[model samples]
Target chain A: MDMQSVITAAIEAVAAEQGKTLRPLTDDLVLLESGLDSLCFAILVTRLEDEVGFDPFTLSDDVYFPVTLGDFIRFYDDAARSQAAPTLAA
Target chain B: MQHAAKPLRRWLLEAERGRGRALLAPGTRLTLDALADTTGLGALRGALADRNVLVSTGSQLAAAEALVELDGLARRIVLAPPDLKPTDIPAVMAGAGIDAVLCDGDHPGFGPDVLIAVPGPRVPLPDAAAAEVRDTEWVLLTSGTTGLPKMVAHSRAGLIGAIDPSALAPVWGTFYDIRRYGGLQILLRALIGGGSMVLSQAGEPMADHMARLAAAGVTHLSGTPSHWRRALMTPETASIDPRVVRLSGEIADQAVLDSLRRAFPGVAVGHAYASTEAGVGFEVTDGREGFPAALLDADGAVAMKVEDGSLRIRSTRTASRYVGGTARALADRDGFVDTDDLVERRGDRMHFVGRRSGVINVGGLKVHPEEVEAVINRHAGVRMSLVKAKSNPITGAIVVADVVIERTFPDTDAARAQAGLKAEILDLCRATLPAHKVPVLLRFADALAVTPAGKLARHNA
Candidate 1:
């Protein structure tokens, strides 16, 4: 139901695709330095886009390179909030 | 020397001798004059004089320049793919017997000092080097679908002799990286034919790349069926309209051919049959799946035959030798080299029947099943593993693995243990194998199906 749980479920789905297990998710967990390889990270982003209905990587004009799990979750959160911000302004 | 009839180097020098567009990419463009002056290519000519050099630049411009200049400068030149993992570079360098590596940017952490960055800006080309393009050996790596990539040695003359002269346009675009065999053919075709090219950078988005090629006004475009399929799926496909569209590397099945024909109506669509060992073979422009049956014995530039279902080809352009690995002869007494690609007679033509060797083609790239299986088998909990191909709509085929675990767990928690082991095995595979070679699907089986011959069955569920 929460942003963190949504991100974690997507990550787990990708890890499940490769039969990989992830270290427990934490704020400072370096995604690249974690068990996820580049391919798994890519799949995670793609799957998360489908589940959450917004892909931060594509929506942001400014390139955002998120190294940690918190940065990744916040990236989507910021994109989602930004989408709602326009509505809030209206 | 006749201007129209010249080798790749001579044509490049004459066409771009003053200042001509030699290479083009999205953010980078190098002229013949710029290539000669700034790229340290002139200095590289002298530095590699009488020496064997490996042109392994990650930059497309640098690679094109190195390949063009090194033809006459180096006694032996090996073109190593820039995408090769850092850990795989040393063995490749040592195997190719390279004395120096011509690259730009950071050293890929191999043969540290052997890296000679492509030279920088100079006023004029270095005083004409005394080196003549002697029996200069051109070594290229075969896409190791069966085992480790092997260095296939070829001569400049042999490579150039195969280019079919064309009166087509000047601008060319190709999906191949010049480092590989298929890409080199396109590179040489443009170089020897006095044409410019739009180089596709690896890892660039296909839609954007297609748009770039369109913006470059590319008249002739060449790519694998997988590439064309991927490109068509992209929204930018409508932007590029090439006069000539060619496919190679993987089988151009009727479905792909028809789709390409439908997508690019009125454009010429054709596929050529060629391999690392066989050089360039017969090409069919009939918009069909395979070459005409008559090419088997027709008097042509090359010769072909089918022996025990495998196609064999012999021609001047065929590879000169296998540089590394077992010193086994590549060809038999009569010059015919077995392509190891099985072919079957289908009506009036011969259709490719997959590789006789157990190599699965994932798109245009080859993924050796045994190689992935070996990595999977290394996992502590994996008792045995069987890697095989699973067809996909995008990539022609993807890798899938079936593994039998070494240990058993209680029924309630068996699923959890199985999932854990599966992930571990995949992790091990990712560390050892290339990304494409990693199995897309991992399944834990009670037992792997075996053939009557007591070998693990590879195909069919």
Candidate 2:
């Protein structure tokens, strides 16, 4: 499955487990405003890592906190690509 | 001779005829007489006399042997736990003024003036070596609010003030390592209380220990709540039956108490409030979570009262003083040891909420992990749980929980069943606890980590 679909499914799965209804998962959807709660994001990342083979938070040295659904998905996608093919440091 | 002046070897009691009690270790067993053996202890006593000694043995079994022999010989005996970090050993040695090191074997770790004695079953003690000597101060290490271990000193009379040894001649077993206060209580009980003790192996498996306890016919067993939870998980728990079960060192939540009662039908399952510093406060055997409110008002040897949610006990049972380091006074001017365990009054009973220092700051509110864990553990699916804080930019920190499922569900609907259990746990938390105390992140674990002290490890995720 594509990274976006996988990430979306994981978020839905975690929300379903928590009995929470998410505001529509869209590119510009702000996570803080959504029904998802703080620290529940850990469950999302854990589920995502099991399905997809990477946890973006630990793989990259750069500190980044994604604010939107798109940013979250993009971060995981970039982490996966970088993990699969290491690029030379600029 | 006074009991205080007598060594633990003198405390050893032998049952009439063939009923002699023994220290039953996994690979070996030593009867009461063997424990009283002065074969090598005669010269060893002279060498260790009037010295500040550190017992850093490799095993709990060795510790028992060392403690029995060294109790009266040394001016002060400091117990070094088997898992003492290498980095912290020197500080411990310096703090307690540990001049001599006693070990089971040769040691490069202790210091230059190392004394060695291989403790095990030996020849019967000679009658001449049984004479009592000067009183020795028993020093125990407590990891107080300050992370570093502090040396707490106690007298023989103080340690035994609360233990009313049984007349039934019961066999004792414990999940606690004997170096710690909880485990040391059991060893003392077996020695002076006319019972045999089954000591847990240093790195033995839980299943193996339970099997050993069963083989030794353990009539009474004691451990922290964490140990009992893990024991309940092990299959051998069913075979290892005891007449009486006890819990100390950690909060005994309703879930574990009810579970123990269910596990051992008609057995006397009790929980006591005891610590390295507070000694033994009281025992509640009515199968309740906490002690009765009347206990506080009642006149007893141990005077207890809750001040600002923390339980304070003033009694002869409490450790006398902080032996070394710039440690704060063990007791206040009123001679009360601040237990630092927070308890909440619910009707007539005061349930232990959590440690006063272990509170997790959830936003501006405080959440005790033990309280959250109690709520989560009440769920039938959850065998055990650890509630910890997860750092969040939004709320400073948020509560997170890792739950260990009691049993495996069928593969056909396992995922669904687990999800349903998680939802139920969250619902239970919501119904019982405040919103801020509710765990935001929940994940199932195969097993939760327990520390060497046999309490739940609560490192933030």
User: Candidate 1 lDDT, tens digit per residue, B1-461?
Assistant: 64323434555545536536557887877765454444355545566776778877777767887776677667788887755656666777777777787777766555555746455553455554335445578898876523567788887767777675565536888888878888888788777665678888877888888888988888888887657655655679888888889888766766567767888999999998878778888789999777787889888779899998889999988998898767579888999999987777878888775667777876677776655665675565655667887654335566788887656789999888888887788788778777778887688877765421123556632
TM-score (chain B only), all candidates: 0.75, 0.95
On a 0 to 1 DockQ scale, where is model 1?
0.03
Model 2, DockQ value?
Answer: 0.17
Give each model's whole-structure lDDT: 0.72, 0.82
**Which runs of model 1 end up more than 4 angstroms from their true locations?**
A1-90, B1-8, B16-20, B36-44, B108-117, B129-132, B359-461
**Residue A10's lDDT in candidate 2:** 81
The backbone clash count of each candidate, in order, is 3, 2
Candidate 1 docking class: incorrect
